[model samples]
Target: MDTRIRRGRRALVNWLERLHRLAPAKSVVWVPAGTFALILVLWIGTISRIQAEGREARQAAAGATSQVASSFAAHIDKTVHDADVAVRWIKYEYERSPSTFRLDTYKEKGLISAGTALQVTIVGPDGEVLQTTTPEAQPVNVSDRRHFLAHKSSPDIGLYISRPVLGRVSHHWTLQFTRRLNNPDGSFAGVVVVSEDPDFLTTGFNNLEALGVGGMLVVMSDNGYLLSRLASGEHASPVGPPASAYREMVDAKGEGFTDPVDRVPRIVTYRHSTQYPVAVLAGISEKVALAGYRHARDLYILMAGLLTVVLLAAAAIITATMTRLVAARARMQHLAETDALTGLPNRYLLTEILRRRIGRERPLDRLALLFVDLDNFKRINDALGHQTGDELLQNVARRLVRVAGNKSFVARVGGDEFVLVVEGMDVAVAARDMARSIIDTFELAFGLRGNSYVMRVSIGVAVYTAESETEYDLLRQADLAMYAAKEEGRSANASRYHTFAPDLAVRGMRDIERQQELQYAIQNNEFFLEYQPIVSLDTGDTLGVEALVRWRHPEKGIVLPGEFIPFAESTGFIIPIGELILEAACAQFSEWMESDPRPLYLSVNVSAAQLVHGDLIGVIRQCLERHSIDPRRLKLEITETAILKDAALIARRLKELRLLGVRVVLDDFGTGYSSLAHLTNLMVDGVKIDRSFTRGVPGDRTALAMFQSIVSLTHDLGLSLVVEGVETEQQVNWLRRFGHIEVQGFYFCRPVAPGSLQAGRAA
Candidate 1:
C-alpha cells in the first residue's frame, strides 16, 4: 500500500524489460531480470519500515512534551495568583491603618499560610523597619533591593518579581513579589513584598512519572533572570548565575515559546501563565516518549523483512535452471569476441571498435594504430611446449595493459600479435616513442615453467588521414610497415619500430606486380640501358657515359628503376639485373671505339647486393672479352656503403678488376659515410660528388664548403674528380672557379637511349 515502494518497483520493472532486448530473441526471458526484480522489491520494503518508524517517533515526542508543558503552566499560574491576591489584601490593610499592620495577625489567622507565598512584609516610606511575618524580627532595610526601588518610584509598576535572594525573616532563598503602596492622594507610601520559595511548584512533581528521570522544570523571570530549576527531585541553588535558552522567543511578548533544551538540541516545551510574570518550561525525554512505539515497530519490520526474503528465495528456486542456461549463452558470446589465450579482444571486436571510431570521428581528429608482432616467436613455440608458450603470451598481454593503461586501447588479434589504438592529433608523430615503450615491456626475460625466455617485438604504426581512408586501409598500412620492419632488420637494434608512409602502400602494390613479373622481364629481354653523358665543365667535351636501366612494362609504359630496384635487391634479382647493364655498357664502349675513338669509357652502377653475391670481376672480364673491347674503356661506379659491407671481399675484387685494366670510381661520394672509410681503405680512380651536394653548392654555404673540402681531399689523394647534378648556370659558374673538373648532370643533357646519344659531346 506504500506509494514509494510501488513507484520504485515500477521503475525497476521497466529497466528489466529493456535489458531483455540485449538477450537472444527466442531464448528464455533474461534470467537476471528476475533476480533484479526480487532485490528491488525487498529493498523497497525495508525502506518503508524505516520511514514509518521515523515519523511515529517524531510525532509522539512532540505530543508528550506539549501535554507536560500545559500541566506545569496551570500549576504555576495558581501559585502566582494567590501571591498576587495576598499582596493586594496586605496593601488594603496598610491603607486602612497607615504606619501599623498585623502581618503576624494575618499569619496567625492562616490566610498567608494557605497562600503560595511564604511570607508577607510592609516597609515604611523612609525605607526602614519593615514589618515581616515573624514573632521576633531583627530590623532590616530593603531600600537597595530591586523590587523595592521598582515599586517605590513607579505607581503602576504593578507586581514585581526580584532575582532569588535569602530573606532576613524567612531565612530561605526566595523570589520576591512586591507591589507599590500609594496614599489616598496617589502619593508613594512604601512597598508590600511577598516571597515565593519556588519549591511549592515541585510539590507533586515526584509522583508524575511522565517527566522521566532526566526531565527538567524551570521557572525564570520574564527578562531571562532564572528564579529556580527543579531537575528531578532536587532544586538548583538560588545563588547561581541566571540562564536562558529561548532569549529571542521570550523577549517578544508572545504567550509562550519552546526551544532546544540547554542548547543540546533536545526540545523544551514552555507555556507562560496568562495572569503571572513567570513562564513554565517542561522538557520531557524524547526517548522515553517514543520507547514503546519504536520497540513494537522494530519487531514488526524484522518480521516483514524475513517474510520478503522467503518469498524471494522461492522465486529464485523456480527460475534457477533458466538462469544457468542464460548465463551459459552470455559466456559463449563473450568468448566468441575474445582471445582465449591472452583474454584480450579478438579481431572481430578490433574491427568493430575501429569502424565505430571512424564513424564518429571529426575532421582533424586523428587516430594512431600500432600493429605489434613478436619477432621469431615461432622459435620459442618450437623450443618450448605449447603450454609454456601460452603462459608467455598471457604475461605479455598483461604487461601491455599495464604499460598503455587507459591511454590507449590494446587488443590481441592473433597468435603473438597485438594492436593498440591511440586517439589524438597526429599521434603518429609520437609513434616512435610510444612504440619504443611497447618494446621495452619485453626487456626482462619472461619466466615460464622452469625456464626463462627472452622475446622481442617489432611494431609498425599508422596514423589516420582525413581524406577517403577507411578503417581497413589504416590496418593494412600498419601491417605493411610491420613486415617491412621485420624484412629490413631495422628492429634488431635501435628504434625497433617502423611508421607507415603513403609511398610504402604504393610500393607495396607495385612490389606484388614486380615480384610476379620480375623474372619474366629479365628473361624476355624486356630490359634496356639508358646513358647520361659525363662532360668536362670548362672544355664542354664528353669524356664518359653512365649506364642506367629501365623496365618497359607492356601495359604501364616505361617503369623507372626506383619502382623495382629495392624490390630486386631484396629478392636477389639485382644480381641477374646487374649482368645485363654490365654487358650493355661494354658493348657500347666497343661501338664508340669503332665509330670514332677518343678514349671514351662506359661506367655501370654496381648494387650493394651484387658486390656481396655476384662474381663482379668475372662478369666484367667476360663482357670485355666477349665484346672485343679493351678493359681500359670499362669503369664500374660503386657506392661507398657497397664496400662497407664485407670490405675485404669487395676490396680484393676491386684489385683484380684494376689489375685487368678496369677503373673503379666512387659514386654518390658526399652523401654517405663522410668519414672517408671507403676512400682510405679501398683503391679508387676518382670520386663523383652526389647531386644533393652539387645542387646546394650555389645557394647553401655549408654545402659549398663541403664541396670545396671534397675537391681538396680528392686532389690531395691524386684521384680524378667528377661532379654530378649540375643543373643551372649558377652551379657551372661556381665549379669553374675551382679549376678544371669533370662534371655531368641535367645542365649538359638527360640520360638517353643507346643509339640516341653521340659518343663525345653532350646533345
Candidate 2:
C-alpha cells in the first residue's frame, strides 16, 4: 500500500511539472495551499468580527424598543386621565344646575375642553328628556343605552365608559362617559353623560416619536371593545388591536410587552385608565422599532462583505500577477507568432514556415500560396461600425481555416488578407478547391446583431516554382493576383479570383494610374456631356435626347464610361461627376428649349452614389431654377441597381421628384440585380430597355416576344418605352410594331456634341 501511494505521488509530481513550466517541481505543492489558508483565515476573522458587532447592536436595539414602548403607553394613560377628569367635571356641572345644564358655563369655568369632549348631555328620570352641548339637538331618550341603564340600575356604578358608537347629535364615533344622578330620596332620577372624541384623544399620540411610522396607539374596553386606534402614518391596522392584545395589554398595566399584534410582531406597552373602564395601548412595530439596530447590523455586515471583497480582489490581483509571471515567456512567444485578432498564424510565423520548408523540403513538395482579400469589406466596416468589421474578419478567418483544413497552413497576413500555404504535387488543385470553398462559404449570409450581410472574397493563387526568387516574392505575386481578382469583380457584383501571371502586375499598375488620373480629371474638368436623340422607331421622329457623360483624357483621348464609372462609384467620385453632368445638362437643355421648342425632352442618368449621398431633388430644383426650364421636359434616369440596395431611400426621393413634376425614368431596365417589384413600386415616367436585350432581336423569337411584352406592360402602366442598341433598319421596322416605342442607339445617331445636336436640328 505504501509503494502504491508513492507511485501516485510520483504521478502527481510529474503532472504538475508538465503543466506548470515556470514553478519548480518541489515548491508547486505548498504555494497554492498557503494562499488558500490565508484567504480562509481572512474570511473567518472578518465574519467573526461582524457577528460580534451585530450582537451588540441587537442588545442595544432591544433595550431601546422596550424604552420607547413604555414611554408611548404612559402618554396614552395621561391623555385618557385628562379626558376622565373632564367628564367628571361635566357630571359635577349637571348636578349643580340640573334644570339649566349648559356645557358653555363649564367650558368658561375651564372644567371641560371642547377638543376632547364631543358632547355633554343630561337625561331626566323617566329617560324622556335630554339636554346636550351640541347644536340642533332634538330630545333623545337614553332608555336603552348601556351606559345610561348601567348608571340607572346600579346607582354606584361611578363613571361608566360605554362602547364606541356614532353619536346621534355629535355625528362622530364617540365613547360616552355616563354617571348616575340621584334625587334626595336616593332613587335614580337621571344620568349625566359626557362624550369623548376617541380620534381626538389619539391624535396627539400619533405625532409622538415612540409611535412612529407603522406604529399605533389603541383605546380598548377592558372586555375587548376597541374605541379607537391611531396607525395612519404607519402601515398597521386601526380597526382594533390583535386578539392576543387583551392578554398582554390588560395584564401589562404601565409596563410594555413584545408580541405580534394583528399578525405583526410589535413591542407594545399598555396601561388601564385609573378613572375609566378603558385601556390605552401603545405599540411600536417590531420592524420599525428595530430600524436603528438593524441599520447598524447591516452596516457591520456590509463592512464585513467589503472586507471579504477586498480580500478576494487582493487575492485575484496576486494570483493574476503570479499567473502572468509564470506564463509571460509563452504568451510573448505566442503574440509574436500569432495574429491576435483571429488567432491565425501572422506574417512572421508564415515567413518562418516558408523558410524552413524551402530549405528542408523534398523537390516534389510543390507549394501554392493563396492570398484572399474580402471585397467591399472596408465599405461595410465604415458603414456598419468597426465591431461588425471585426466580426466579419473573424468569420472570414474561420471560414479560411475550415476550407484550408489541416494540411494547409492558413495565416491571417493582415486586414482582410490571409495566406494559405499548401503542399503536394497537385497543390494548385487543392488551392483552387480551398478558394472555391471560401467563396461558397461567403455566399451564405452572415447574421449579426439582427442584420444579415453577404461578403465576397477575391482570391489570388500562386504556385511555387524553381524560378521563384524567395517566399516573399511568392506572397507578393499572390497579392498581385488577388488585386486582379478584385479588378475582375469591379465589373460584376459577384466574387471573382485569378492566378498569378507575368503581365498581371503591369495591369495592376495601370489600373492604379487610371484611378489617380480619374481623380485629376474630376478636378481639371476634362469631362463633357453628349446628347443622343431618342427617335420613334415608327416615324424616325426625334422625341427626346439622352445626355451621356464622356471623359476626354489628354493622352488616352475620349474614354468610355464603362472604363471609369465603376471606379468612380466605388470611390464615391460618381456623386460629384453626376452633379457636374446634371448641372451642365440642365443648363444646356434649358437653352435648347428656348431656341427650338420641338417637343424635346432631355434624360440624364443618375448614379447610385448621387441618389444616396447627394440631394438629387435639391440639385435638380436648383438647376431648373437657374435654367428657367419646364420640369416636365427634364428627366432624371436612374438605373434599377439602386433600388435593390437602398429601395426605401430611393423610393422616397423619387416620390419627391414626381411631386416636383420632373419626369423620372428607370434606365437599364433588365440588367440590374434588382426585382420587377422595384419597377412597380417606383414612380417613374419611362423605362429604357438596356442594349443587351436588343442584341438578340429581329430574328430571335424569344427576344421579340420579350420586347413586345415589355412594350405592352410599359404602356399599360402609363410609362413610355424606349428600345436601345438598334443598328439595323429591319430591327427598327420590326420594333415599330410596338406602337410609339422610342428607339435610341448607334443606329439612329451616336452620342453627339451639343453643337452637333443643334446643327442636326437645323438640317
Candidate 3:
C-alpha cells in the first residue's frame, strides 16, 4: 500500500510539471512561440464563434419582438377602422332625417327595433335635453365636455364617441356615440346620441392564447381610465394603465409601445388613436412569448458547446503533431472591459482608466468629470419598446464619444446614465462646452418610424482640483454636482467648492425652516394681525388697513411679511397662512367696529391656490359669521397671475365672492401677463400699481409715465387706483400729481405691529 501511494504522488507531481511547461512564456524564440500563437488563434476563433451566435440570438429576439408588435398594431388599426366605418354610417343616417332620427323615434321603435342598443337621447346646442327614449334617465349636461362640443361644431358633423361611461338610462356599461344635426342651410342644430354595449367592442379580444398561458387584454382612455378587459381571474377588477406605463404613453401621441410590466414579465402594447384620442392597450405574458425561444436558445447553446468541443478536439490533433498552443488572456481582458448591450466601455473600465490617469506623472492635472443622466429615460424604454431603447442608448453612446473627441473618456455607467471624464488644463471651459454640446445633441428632432421623439439630458459636472487625490473623492463630487443638475431640471448644472457658501447653501434650508416655522406659528397662535391703515385721499378718514403677515419668531423677534412671505407662497403653506390672517383681521375689525362704529374695511391678500379653491366663498361666509362682521366690510386682494390663470374659474369664484358682498381687488396689476385685459374682464374694486413702478417712479420719467397712464386708465374704467411702496415725501408728492393718493409704503409705516400701527397712521 505504501509503495502504491508513493508511485501515485510521483505521477501527480510529473503531471503538474507538464502543465507548467505548457504555461505562457514571452522568452520562447520559435517552438513554444509558434505553439502559443496557434493556441491564441484557436481561442480567438472560438470567441468569434460564440459572439456570432450571441448576435444571432439577439437578432432573433429582436425580430420576434418586432413581429409581435406589428401584429398587435395591425389588429388595433383594423378594429378602429371598422368601428369608424360603423360610426360614419350611423351619422349619415341621422343627418339624412333629423326629425325622424330624434330620441322620440327611438322611443317609439322600442327595444325590439334597437335590439342590444341601449337608451337613446337627443340634446340641444346648450346641452339641455330635447328628448330621451327613457323618462327615468338622469339628466346629463354634455356642454361642459370639449369632445361633445368639437363634434357639434365640425363641418362634417361626424359621429363622436366618448370614452366609456356608465349608462344612466340602461344602467349598463356603454360608450356614448353622438351625431350632430344641422339645419338645411348648414346651421347648428340638436344632437342625436346612442349608447353601445361594451361587449360589442371587446368580443374579438376576449379569447387569445399567449404562449399557452392565460393573459389579459385591456382597453383604456388616453389618460389611463380602464374601459374594458378580457381577463376574469384576480385581474377581474377593472384597471387603468399602470402608473409608470401611463406616464410614458400619455405623451406618446399616435405611437405604439411595448414595455414590460412592473416586476411581472409581460409585454404591454399601447396605441393612441389619431381620430378619437383614446388609447388601446393589450398585454401578453412575456414568460409565455419567449418559452419556445428560450428552449431553442438553450438547445443552440448546447450545440455551441458541442461544436466548441469538436473544434478543440481538431485543434488538439493538429497541435499535438505541430507542438503548438494558444493564449487568449489579452482578448479576454478586452471583453471584460466592454459592454455587451452597447460597444462602449463599461463602468469597470471607466474606473480603471480614471485610476490610471490619476496615477500618471501629471497627477495633479485639472480634469472635469461629468455625470450624464438621460431625462425620463424610463419613458423611452417604456414607450418605444426595450429593443428601441437599447438602440437609442447605443446611438447616444456613439454621439457622446464623437462629441468628447479623443481628449475625454466616456463609459456607460448603468442604464441610461454615462460618465465622461475630460482631462484638460482648463477644466471649467471643457466642462461647460461638453455640457452645452450634450444638451444640444437632444434638441434636434429624432425620427423613428415616421414619428419624432425629442429627448433631453441633464449633466452634472465636477472639476477636480489638485486637492482631489483619491478616486472616491472625485466621484463623490461628480455625483453631488449631478444631483444639483437634476434639481435645475437636468439641462446643465455644476457644483463647486465655492458653491457651498453660507448664504447660497442655506437659502433653501432657511426657506424650508421658515415655512415650518410659519405653519407652527399658525397652529400655536404665535401669529397676530397687523393692519396698515389705508386712509382716504379725499376725506382724511382711515378707510382700512391692509392686513399684513407678521411672524413673531421666538429668538429672532418680530419678522416682517417681506421676510417670510415669499417662502410661504412657494411652499403652498400660504393657503392656510393667508386664511389665518383673513380670519384674524376680520375678527379684529369686528371688535374695532363695535367700539368706534366707523365704516371700516380690512383688505387681505389671496394667493393663486387660494383663489382657485372651490370653497373660497364658503370660507369668506364662515369667517364673516364667526366674527359677526358684515361681508361688505371685508376686501379680498388677488394678484394679476391669480386672475389671469384660468380666468373663467377665477371670474366665477370672484363673482360668487362679490355676490356674498366681499369686495375683490386685482393687486400687483402690471406685473403679470395682460394685466389690463384681466382687470377689464374681472369685476375688481381697485387696481394697485406693482411696487416695481412705484419704487422707481419718483426719479425716472418712464416709470412715472407708466404709473400715470395706469392711474388714468384705472380712473377712466371707474376703478380706484392705489400706489404701493410709497417711501419718501417725493414719491408721495409725485404720486399725488398723478391723482393716486391711497398708498401703502415705508413712508406710512414699515408693516408695524398692531400695537404700534395707530402711532403711524397715515391720515
In lDDT terms, which candidate is top? Answer: 1
TM-score: model 2 vs. ground truth? 0.45
lDDT of 1: 0.74
Candidate 3 local distance difference test against the native: 0.64
Q: Pick the candidate with the highest TM-score.
A: 2
lDDT of 2 by residue, 548-647 (tens): 9999999989998988898888778898888899888988887888888587888888887787788888898999899888889888888887666666
- TM-score, one value per model: 0.39, 0.45, 0.39
Q: What CA RMSD would you report for each candidate?
A: 26.8, 28.3, 50.0
Better of 1 and 2 by TM-score: 2
Q: Which pairs clash in the backbone of model 2?
A: 214-234, 260-265
Candidate 2: segments with Cα more than 4 A from true spot? 1-369, 374-393, 402-456, 463-476, 483-497, 536-542, 562-573, 597-599, 612-622, 625-631, 641-661, 671-678, 691-700, 726-738, 745-749, 759-763
lDDT of 1 by residue, 1-763 (tens): 2233233234423433433423345544444466567667666766676667766665666566667777877877767777778888888888888756677777777776735467778887767756887558888887888787887778898988788888877787787778888888888888888887856665645435767766667777786677767665467777654756445444232122333333322335767878777887776544455567667667767766676677567656746766676688669866886777766667876776666557555324367788988885765765576877787787877777666545565678888888877766667665666788887777778887777777777788888876577778888989988877776654254326788888889889977877779888999878888989999877888988888899988788898988888789888999999998788777876777788758777888888778768888788778888898878877788888566556676777888878999889998896665536667878888889889898787889999888888888888888889998999888898899878799998898888987888655663
What's each prediction's clash count? Answer: 0, 2, 6
Candidate 3 wrongly placed segments (more than 4 Å): 1-434, 445-516, 612-618, 641-661, 681-683, 691-700, 727-741, 745-752, 755-762
541-604: candidate 3 lDDT, tens digit per residue: 6667788877788889988777777767767777787778777888777777777667777889
